[model samples]
Target: MAKNKHSGKIVQNSRLLVGLVLLVLSIPYSAEARQKPNILWINCDDLGKELSSYGNQQVHTPVIDRLAREGQVFTNAYANAPVCSSSRSSQILGLYPTRLPILNHRNMSPVALPDSVPTIMQLFREAGYFCSNGAAGDLAKPGKEDYNFVAEDLFDGTDWRQRQEGQPFFAQVQIHEPHRTFVHDELHPIDPAEISLPALYPDHPLIRADWARYLESVQRADRWVGEILDRLEEDGELESTIVILYGDHGRPHLRDKQWLYEGGLAVPLIIRYPNSLNAGKVDHRLISLVDISASTLGLAGLPIPIDWDGKDIIGGAKNSYIYGFRQRCGDAVDDIRSISDGEYKLIWNRMPEQPYMQLSSYKKLQYPAYTLYRDLDQKGELSAPFSAFMATTKPDYELYHLKVDPYEIENLADNPAYQGELLRLKEQLERQLQAVETYPQEESEALIQQAKSSSRKYYQEAMQRRNLGPDPTDAEILDYWNHELLLNQKPKTKK
Candidate 1:
């Protein structure tokens, strides 16, 4: 009987040991179930909210639409600026476009972000998350290279997929399709007659054909996004990843890109965070692309850097206002500033030297059909279908009631009825500008020096040429100096 009791106790201890083993195993699964999500930011170039999912019945974007269905859709999302570099800089840095001196669209020179300023990558890396970026086109070099993964191929996201095993990762995938220089024959096999022209464009056949080609390019970008999503699924990483798909800026056509109108600034933002987010929720709060940096940091379980000017959007705060500015696109130098509160938009043009409706770019000048629309607009022939996108210079103040006229066709600045609302937006714009404008000129100058120092090796070689260059003619000396400068500078890597 004692021998039988001993065997029974052994069995009981064995059962206890199995339970303990199960509990220990369950800990990791439970931890992993609550683990911080891996972030995948898919930033597309030159896409607007023209998808059927975003209330436009014109374009089809199945992958982006799927993301919207699976997560939250932000209809009132605005880029910090209407151009790629400025808007994208704001997205990663959480600073306004003007805060960076490179906000001037005409100044296309490299503007390296200071190393002292903390980026989302810096914050995530500190928090034990690996960061990788597959930036597209010219978006990968200069100030952005320090934070993003610089690679040869533009279409691949493999670098982002192979991060550390247990640690979370922040991967940014940028697509450069749909920007200008779209091929007509290859991209747009569809008939131009079938294309619906935005009222801002003259009903010219060439204009419609150009617009169709642009649409085709946008469709191609959607296909690339679908491929990325498929890759995530294949890697079994989709469920654990928080995917956000958005546009860097509006298109580079009429009423887009260089303007401060809805077509220029407003973009589609779809967040698919099944791990921590409730799906199918549509958020219409006026959130800027700058908020993207804050939201990214917040979701990564990192504190929003204090120097960041963007607001943390996960707290259900109703963002009432977002600002926008336009300097120079190509060669047009216009100082246009604007602010929007989802319901109303007010614009202030500091340089009232020219008419508000103008195009300074080479292509637009070359295409007489493109100028026809602007000429018609100046004559008030075409309804303000795309007035918000007009680059033409106007008087100091302009106002539009977005609730009544969402297209911003009618300017109410001269009307007495909206004096109160106009004044309110103006004050709010000034207040927000002042709040984030603390980046001192001296600080920026210091940052510029740091940026210059990054290319010191090239500068040293250029100085050698400068010392040897004492040509008889002034132009020859200048040419030699320029050649030296060019030789020393690092070239942008292959796409």
Candidate 2:
């Protein structure tokens, strides 16, 4: 072996050649493995699970249906808080809103995030990801970051396309549809008679008309989603991005928005992984909006913060139950908390003295069901189910098994047979409350007076706008709304 130097040199050259070939082969694989996913969170305000994808044919949401068909569907996702500000605050940080004291709709003076807590956007930006919050509107405007926190200039820009070349981006695009002031979508009109009105409200013509308008708004929102997805596809970002489409909360209606009922807490969640990975997979686990943040981090190949309240649900691990709470939305000071394990749900109305249909300014002006409930009670026509829920006072605790009672009208808190389930959820709530900031038990007199005064003034003004008398009957109210819906017909004369 020591005799031939040329032969030794030839064998050494051959070994080096093989090493170079292997190194070259591994570079592209390593780069591909290290490549992070761009995240696009498509949020539609006040949208419910009414799309055709969710089995509501009245809602014509082709774009969202396609997303459902091509992605993983979460059948039982909920907003941790019903209102926008609280839910957004909870999800953005992967923590409960009470811990941050962002439970209110909008604090007159918002508190900035503490030094210790970092937002998901903050984490992504630290990882060199470009973060953008923009409106998915016709105009390229800054997105509605209606977070009850100080969020001015927290984002890099309003456009994900403005990111540095080859940089991954996290974009939150707000589509304000089906929120309020819903009118008939002329382009996509839904027949009022076709709407499936919930049993919680009076089945009046005005209510049906309003529900139809709500679906029309959803149809409009669906078009917005289609536009966003098309733009991504045109830009060659669709296949590389993890697109998440969801409602911030439930539909803005009588029992839905700002309440702890399933209508308010439940939201439809659809996630399309890059290249349609795991398409058509449906997850029936109970999940909260907060889990989305941690899951997003996980999908992006980032380390989730250990202090975060949410877990990485993308790994198939799920929470047994999701929680929801409400406090001081629209000047109403009733504190409510709810827990649901997908089938069973519980509500704790800490201040039951405040009625469910309290003097909330926006509801009086926007919701027709509010008027029907008040008018029916005055005539002593309010019956069992309606009277129980719309009474002057509410029960301290209400429980329902949603699998059997989808409407949640029947209260089983006192039912002897359901004592075990009630106790379980009650104990769970106590544990949850202990971990967060203590809730305020007493209502502020000043806030109550202010809210009532504002509500009465707005209500009277709204009535006047509809050409209604000081004490108009339900028929009169229906007459005006019917006229509004029928633009081709002559307007109804004021009484």
Candidate 3:
């Protein structure tokens, strides 16, 4: 296990002129793979490092834990963007969304990938390897393709079994478990009291119970992982295939998923290579999620695109910095950029005047905890740090020393003692920002209001179904979601 020590230092890199891949590898670059391994990408939705392998004992993910034991577990991996569509769109082409200028989530209009960059699926099919993207466990079912850009004919079929005999397969299996509206696992129940609430959340049973339910979704996803591996074993391909399991971004929580915080941008990455290569090793290399694409092309013995943003992570130099972005997620409109160099992180909130929860209809509908947070803050039950989240306005810049302040509750940006460090990273990140073409940040307010109006329809319907009184408190909202949705019981009769 590689240790990440806080040097309280910054290394200025002048070569951030391309993709959001400044965190380049320091190890010698090598792409020697004579035997092309069948790649299996198990991409789960809105999942973070909740598995036992990552040291969260509450969620019993034996299969994923076993994979961690038999594979290389990455400790420092961040998504290029917080939202799924933006991350998915840039990842396949081995570039960043801002560099490709496809930062919109659920974009009504999408541009095709640059003619220079060919998707890995197209290349794999051209190389005679079968490509499939389907649900986890049952590959016959069509999987989620929430790409922000226009991608066509990306898959050969829904399942690898349809491929010609002896043909290698590159399967992109998307697991939907653990996203939202978590399914309770009856067989392995977790105690609500056993959960640990983050500082951003109030220490309440409702919050813990909500967390336990999310763990149930994690358990369900884990069981399906076992089923996927079992099928590979039964088909006599387990030993020959290279399985790469990762989350699209982070957990589906109140402040996660759509934000640029660590809870939203961070994800779990595990690579199980055939013949037990690099098995049982825990690598703490600073890496971005897009590196998987470049690594994929290298693993397939194909020539990587010259303009591909990500580099081969298998054997690369130490990362200087990794960048992330948040822009136009769902009905919410915001522009936030982040740059981290393993120890220190800097977040630039372009629209700092706006409140954190500014008409994000998805959060209002899907997360009962969202209501609870606002209610608690309104009641003055929430203290410093966490209460700051509910503030009407945010600081233009936020900085955290991740090694010392892993939870990111402290704001070192305004502290006079850290002025030198703050300005250094700020100027450094600004230069990095200039390199990428993030045009969507300049989108009009009219376009945003139109999209918000469209998404509000679904939120209104869900709220109507619950039928909480117009002035219902957060307690009533939480209780409604808990009993009505999770327990499969109707909401309490509104009197």
Candidate 4:
């Protein structure tokens, strides 16, 4: 009887041991089951809310429109900066460009992101998500992430398919479209006559033609979107992946690409997830691109860093205003800061003595409409709205009631009726500047000198490459500058 009891005890001990082994074996699978969803971020360059979904009849973006129909569309999404480098820097680092050394677009000497500020991808990587930055073509060139401190460390590769099985991923795919030098597509030709001119733009044949070309580029961008979606579906990751589609900044036009106006600051933001949270909804809350970093980390179930300047837009409190910063862009050196509360927009031109239209070689070469407008202004043929771009010097402060003046035509800074609103916004701007730790605008004489030196060097290099003589005529120099600008297809180059 004692032997039988001992055997029974041994059998019970063996059963317990087996149960413990089974639990240990199932641990990894359980963790995998609780893993965060994959993220697919698609960023387009030089695009705004020109989609049919945005109530614009001019451009047909069927793929993006369908995404909007099945996703959440942000009606008031603004880029932190008007141009690419500054905006991209802010988006990646979750900090304002003004606070970083990359305050200007295409900074001559690219500023590295501080070691303390980890990129969104880096956060994902630390959270066990495989991160990849497959942004190529004009969008992933050298200067694109030159402002990023350790850009290479942020991503594993340009592709994420090679990631470990059952592992989540964070992928960024950047597309270049609707930018200048619009590629003419015969199959998707837009009618110049049908193109509607904005109030600020002249209704000329050349301007219409340019608009039509831009529409065609938008169509091309739509096709690229379809291709990316198809790839995601092919991988069987479409439903489970959190997809985000947005533009880096507004359209690439005069007073649009580098200016602080709506044409430059406003962008389209659409997000889709399988959980159906706010799906097919339109969020009118003011959102800045900088908010994306924290929001993305929140989506991945990761802890947002305390030093980030942006709030988690997905779950955090709503923002009352979105801010914009503009410093030196290409060869132009200026200081402009703006704040918008979705209804009113105020611009503080720190360098009020500087002309609104600074002589930027890149702008002069790329925008033919700029040349046309300048010629028209010279001839005294420009009207009120069109003539605004030709102002010798901008006002110290400019205020616009977006509801009444959607195009931001009239400035109400000095008006007695709007003084209260202006002062309120001004105070808000001050508070924002302080919160972001932005310093007062300093003179950029050094930056201007650097830009001129770089421009001369680039010209000389191009001429030498072409085997042209060293002595170039005045006309020849101008032609060379234009040609060099065209050859450098990337928007906002850091020379």
Candidate 5:
């Protein structure tokens, strides 16, 4: 009779233990849910540091400004490349562009990112979050229509409104505004005269008109962002969701997009995490867009994949260096490369003997600034700002001490006084590039050969063109300058 009583007691204890396990499982979150944070990545095309919150008082971006009020703003953020394809690819693969074999701009062939490479969407999906994407431009994968979701409007609030009730999600929204080919008539009410032009652009009527249009696009993007934020608040998911708003690359112009200069690669990065981050915080550390991948994974409590070249920047401090490269043959130039360490920037040219053109720069051609530079150069009324766009017949290397000259108006590469700093930076760049495994085996040979051939061809053609002399009214020289600068060899040997 005592043995039977003991057996009944053991059975009752087992039932109690089972009941406790079920209760814990039924809880909304028991340390497991925190590990699966919903992620939202918002990207803008050809957008740079033009937001009022980032200290650009000219451009109005209230929604992004509000996001800054709620979270951290990284002032020194940079893109892997100045172009759309390579920059987007780096973020998607979580690796640097130099590591990729075919991340060149305008290369119609799809540089297939391997399925093994875990994207931010894929990472969250594996960790129990549904991944969805809405793109406004053709910057992402070319033919992959279903890139996880099929939202009709890339910038609209359709997808964000239809997420599953209790499940975690990773949603990416893109805005098509603020891109080039802008409509000039529909600009914001801001007066063109009040705008402070960059040192590289000439003060001409056409340029001012174009700048107005660009600002208008920014306002449109901001309005749409406000709509998205309001919806999030209405759904009661604003606090739990992590919001990331940033640009793919720099502005569209001669010296901006296809070049390795600050105008091209330097981008605005804002992260809004209501539950995790403190408001009005500013991080000045150099962080790359690729680092977003690791940061996202880290926030989700998942380990960063080994193949990624970016570091987790959520702690607000990281590596001091930022690298940028470009590969596009536009107008009159070929390939180029560049790197920056917050204060200094260096550019490597395959073709060094050619005079850098100011009016024909890449970004200028796409916007109204192209006419301004041309008219100014033709009239010989070039100001310090317009002159800044003219690239010198740079030596094999072009270096600038950004702290001393933020506009990059001076070249210090040929100056022997700073040889130590230059050499040290070069060595660091080489080491980091080598550490990335994605660099193609034939990169050196291809770049060296391309550089030599391009130099020879450009030299011969330029001499012929120079002999003809500047036509008193010819706009081609200014046009050529703008074009050549944009084409300037910014090809990144993606290591």
Candidate 6:
């Protein structure tokens, strides 16, 4: 009986030893599972720093304000380009748009990234994470990726939910609000009287109404943000995902969309992570949207490509000044470059002989604000600040002390007192352009002409079908010039 009892005790000890070994083996597996965090990147179109959290009292953005409260808000974040396609192209490829073929907005032939240049999504997919653009319902059309890019193979699907269980994900959700054709929201209407007009714009009823519509669109965008956050919380993935929300560029106002002013280049950026890195803090560091791709790669524990121009803003060295580039926007042709160190801004307009406000059919026909400015200019009722827009010619160089003149009304480039600062910025701009191997605007225009030929044929056909009159005004002449130069065809119809 004694021998039997001793044997039973030995058996119990062996079972306990086996259980202990299994637990030790599972520890590494569990740690590995938790190492890879999900990434959620959200981007909005034509949105500037209009959020209430950014001190815009006219617009109510509760959802975004809540995000700022929970995440890190960047005060001086800027887009590399003021327009959409170019800015977004620079963002995804981690390189300046000037370095790529798609340096302008709405290129007739979309430029594809070289195979050697891997996107952040591609990097994440190779690292064993499921990647997607957004939910399947978010697709605007069947089999059409919303943004520019011919590389559709990078994303696994439209929805991250389709990913395998226990798999991490990298998803981009693009919200198309506050762009053009501002739709009024009855539920959350904005009061035009409350909006503070900028010094550059005349305070007319029409201008006020337009500004109100923009604010309303902002509120509408906020609601969409709330929906996305709610969906994440419901899925129980809020605690495991890192969220980033920002705009593609500045607002769509004149001199704001295609120009290099703060209204055109600056954007709001908010980031949140489960690790709470600088959570609920406002970072005043100068950051560029180009840095987003590399910063994301760093956060995911992946290596950034050496050839990429972007740097990790969160973990890497901060930039002294952010740079901006402007090429052709729609029918307008321009070559403007700028650099700002968060206090002073320097702009170099290569074509100073050209007018600041070019003839753009899209801008003229679509926006009532443009018509109002034209009428006011003709009547000679526009104030000095407002009259600058209608100037016949622009200065070759413009320098503004942004600290004192936030609206950029004064040009201090000619002032002898600012000569030292101007020289410093000019040298920096030259170095940056050389480093990126940026081509002259003429080279870009030549490529644009080649692509515009096809589009010109289509537009000419449409004009003939509509029985439109001859090109008389500057706007019409410019459009016709673009068409004629590309297609080498005269108009069949007459006035």
> Residue 271 CA error for candidate 5 (Å)?
1.0
lDDT of 4 by residue, 146-224 (tens): 3523344667766668677777888888777877667666776778788788877888766777777777888888888
Rank by lDDT (best first): 2, 3, 6, 4, 5, 1
Superposed model 2: Cα runs more than 4 Å off = 1-34, 438-482, 486-495
Show the colliding residue pairs in model 4.
113-149
**Candidate 4 — number of clashing residue pairs?**
1
RMSD of 6: 13.3
Best by TM-score: 3
For residues 1-495, write the lDDT of model 1, one tens digit per residue. 012221222223323443454456544324542377888888877787777678755555677777788899888888878887557656766777666554654242444444445456656654545677764433243112222211232222235545655656778877876776564335425466876776556575556666666677777777778888887789888998989888887766765677787888888888898554778898877888888888877776556655566878865545777889676554455677789888889988877776644434333422334455555557776554444445545668879887877656788998988899889999998887776554322223444344344334343454344453221122333333233222323332212
lDDT of each: 0.64, 0.79, 0.78, 0.75, 0.64, 0.75
Give candidate 1's whole-model lDDT: 0.64
Over the stretch 335-389, how does candidate 5's per-residue lDDT look in tens digits? Answer: 5667788888878775665555622323333443545555666677877645655
| Deviation (Å) of 77 in candidate 1 | 0.7
lDDT of 6 by residue, 1-495 (tens): 012221122223323443454356554224454568888888888899999989988787999998888889999999989988888877887877776555666665554555455567766765567877762235332222334445557678777777877778888877777887686878887666777887767787667767788889888888888888888888888878989999889988887988899999999999987756667899999999999988887887766666678889977659998999887776677788999998999999988877877666556644556656776677788778878888988899999999999989999999999999999999999998877644223445566675455445544565455344423343454344333323335643445
Error of 6 at 238 (Å): 0.8
Give candidate 5's error at residue 87 in angstroms: 0.4
Query: How displaced is residue 198 in candidate 1, in Å?
Result: 3.0
| Worst 10-residue lDDT window, candidate 1 | 1-10
Kindly report which residue pairs in candidate 1 clash with one another: 355-393, 356-392, 356-393, 356-394, 357-392, 358-392
TM-score of each: 0.73, 0.87, 0.89, 0.85, 0.75, 0.83
